[model samples]
Target: MNFAFSLPLALAAALLDVTVGYPQAVYRAIGHPVTWMGAFVAALESRLNRPTLAFEVGRASGVFALALYLGAVGVVAGLVSSLAPSGVVGFAALALLASSLPAQQSLDRHVLAVARGLEQGGLAAGRSAVAKIVGRNPETLDEAGVARAALESLAENFSDGVVAPLFWIALGGVTGGALYKAVNTADSMIGHKTERFLAFGWAAARLDDLVNLPASRLAALWLIAAAAVTPDASAREAWLTVARDAGRHRSPNAGWPEAAIAGALGLKLAGPRVYGDRLVDDAFMGAGRREADAADIIRALKLYRASCVIQALALAGAALIAQA
Candidate 1:
């Protein structure tokens, strides 16, 4: 089936994404664990094997975990659907449950919190907030460093959190979307460059990259389009920056939106960053404009809002087309 329910389902998913993720900080404070046990198991599996063996085990473990999660979600959706007042209500509930489980809004909020902390001259708070979002050490960062990290995360996650799941949902409805989320969760938890995960997380990471490729590009395009709508945003700059710098990053996908945002704001981004004890020398994107600051953070938020508008419009249009 082409999943004719995709459009409304996607809308339901988006709403659920917002609702579930927004309340997480409160829920976390109350010690309600949002932990993905499946991801933890996959991570452990990677740690127990030799390089090649680890890779095999990790891949198998990740796939199995993801399959199990998706299956569970499906079963739950089926049960809920059977009990719902209408087929439409059942499908909507399924979509909401599937899409709401991903951490997009929560991730965005965490990044934004870091930026806000830096803006308020709360360097310590900024570092603490940033620590929650990224794998890198935050204690050594200055204001600009923290802002850069948050903005970069905003760009990268625009693809991961929003676009990737949306793409799968468009293709597969609730079940397909849930499967993508499980794979992505697996990648996030175990896909790392560390010795323990290098072998095991390789498949999950690579597959995530593959799935995110098109979505990332689309995110970049949407960002550029969104920038075009703003009074001072520059589409030409965004496009040129993306063209020149999008390929320079370690990830095939992250560079797209980062470059677009860099170009749109007429500022530079993606230089050296410290991850744990390691220093990563990354290529700079965009032409030299101004140093990153709180204003840039506000601009990033604007881009984020614009992206949401675009997503909503696209989903609406898709629904109309489907109905036709």
Candidate 2:
């Protein structure tokens, strides 16, 4: 499709990622972008997030630290973007770099592995496979719990890991995508309520919330559309579920996709769950069956994959229209 540069860049990167995900060899060679960013975030936190500092002082330092790091990442991405020549090779190289930010293929593989583990070995295998993707305590999970956890992680991350980064890239190209990844990495690492990070993670958490706003809503809509086409999935219920339950989620962004997927598949997700001995009694997203199984995980994967296709098509359409 002949499209404008801004959106085309994101579309190209997304297509590239869907075609071939980040390579294991490349990761071993230089590490992934998020990991590299995490190293920087860890160093900055060690130096800036002092326990001796008072609450507000630590918070201000967090703001400063976030600004410093995000600024550095943005500058670097921009430099790389500028250095690329104005032709096919340069464009391909930039798109390749941008492709690393979205994890559509990997998310599918991880979530699917949970299904395979359940199918092949049972609860222990399911838990083991799921643990790679979710942060909740795997030992506390039963078969249903493992399935729910896997599906929940799949739904939530589809928004965060795939849609949000692509949304930024569609708007601002590689630098924008890189900046979002930096903020997200910071949030994942430090955005905790513990005494150690409650204040220090404020900026990262807040900004992540802001950047993810539009994508979350858009993601829900796409999931709803996906539900319409998938067998036995309820598009009507998906819309109703999102309208009724999306806001009930603890996260501003995660609930949208989670609720849509829950309603589409007629399953309950993200209810009470254990996270490192802490029980988070969050509201359930769908008023459907709580006894989710590997089959349901497969169902959710169908919806997730459909949603990805729908989103990519939407971006392509938007780009074509913009260029026209």
Candidate 3:
């Protein structure tokens, strides 16, 4: 798949996700026993002791998820294609592919849930939400800490949740899209700095980084463009911040968007946060506006929306060019 088809798929996916995702999530919640089974299986997988056993278990989990996702796509694509014209099948494939990708709405909802906990002054609730968003411990975070956690997640996931999947789908079709999701899921489940997963999970994590590189930079550029669109916003500042601070992040790819978002929002991001009992004094990104609150979260949400629009427009342009 190239931009010609991929653009429509991207748009369809974004639209479908925004319009129907909540209901679908609700329906899945109510109807799916498989979800419970998956959770149970994940629990079992998480508890494996031996490294070799863990690797085997991880591999099985990866293959299972890949097969299931791809199989579903194939079945759906076939059904849609059979009932309609080939063009319709193509469009439907795009729609189905889009449906698989996460949306800004979902991301905002999760972050807002955390913000609500923070506003209520319940550290535990806030911590729980933060933990869901980030890998860090919530127990040790302050208000600033919680805000940063959400912001960093917002930035990094903007690439992972939005950009990376679309990039793959456009490049390789539904199979590629599904494969990207599987790899990302594996990274989330097994990729960690913990002693147990250090060696085995390294491959998954590195592969994920490799895949995310271009998408991450694209996300950053989209963010910078978004910043330019805001009244009185400074593209120069955004560029400078991204250039200066993006490298400060631990992950090569993640810092790009985080830095861009911080620069766009004129806020500082990524400082020391508690991970379990240890404090990782990570380098901060951006310069102007360091202190964040609920309002900043709302701003980040706007940035998210703007970035999505930019991405869509870019895809559309690419499609038009291909046609030309």
List candidate 3 stretches off by more than 4 Å. Answer: 25-49, 52-85, 120-125, 231-233
11-37, model 3: which lDDT tens digit per residue?
Answer: 667667666664666656674322433
- Winner on lDDT between 1 and 3 is 1
lDDT of 2 by residue, 1-324 (tens): 223876888888889999999999999999999999999999999999986789899899999999999999999999998999999999899899999999999999999999999999999999999999999889999999999999999988898899999988988889989999999999999988778998899888898899889889988999999999999899999999999999999999989999999999999989888899788989999999999999999999999899999988988998888888
Candidates sorted by lDDT, best first = 2, 1, 3
- Candidate 3, overall lDDT? 0.72
CA displacement after TM-score superposition, residue 43 of candidate 1 (Å): 7.5
* lDDT per model vs. reference: 0.74, 0.92, 0.72
Best by lDDT: 2
Structural similarity to truth (TM-score) of each candidate: 0.85, 0.98, 0.81
Best by TM-score: 2
List the lowest-lDDT window of 10 residues for candidate 1. Answer: 31-40
Candidate 1: tens digits of C-alpha lDDT, residues 1-324: 355577677767776776665354755665222255354545555445455555567557555654555566556544654575557666765765556544567766777788787767578888888787667888878877777778888888888888877777777665566567666776787678887767656767887888888889988988989898876788889999999999998888889999999999888888888887898898887885646776788778887778777876888788888888
Regions of model 2 farther than 4 Å from truth: 1-3
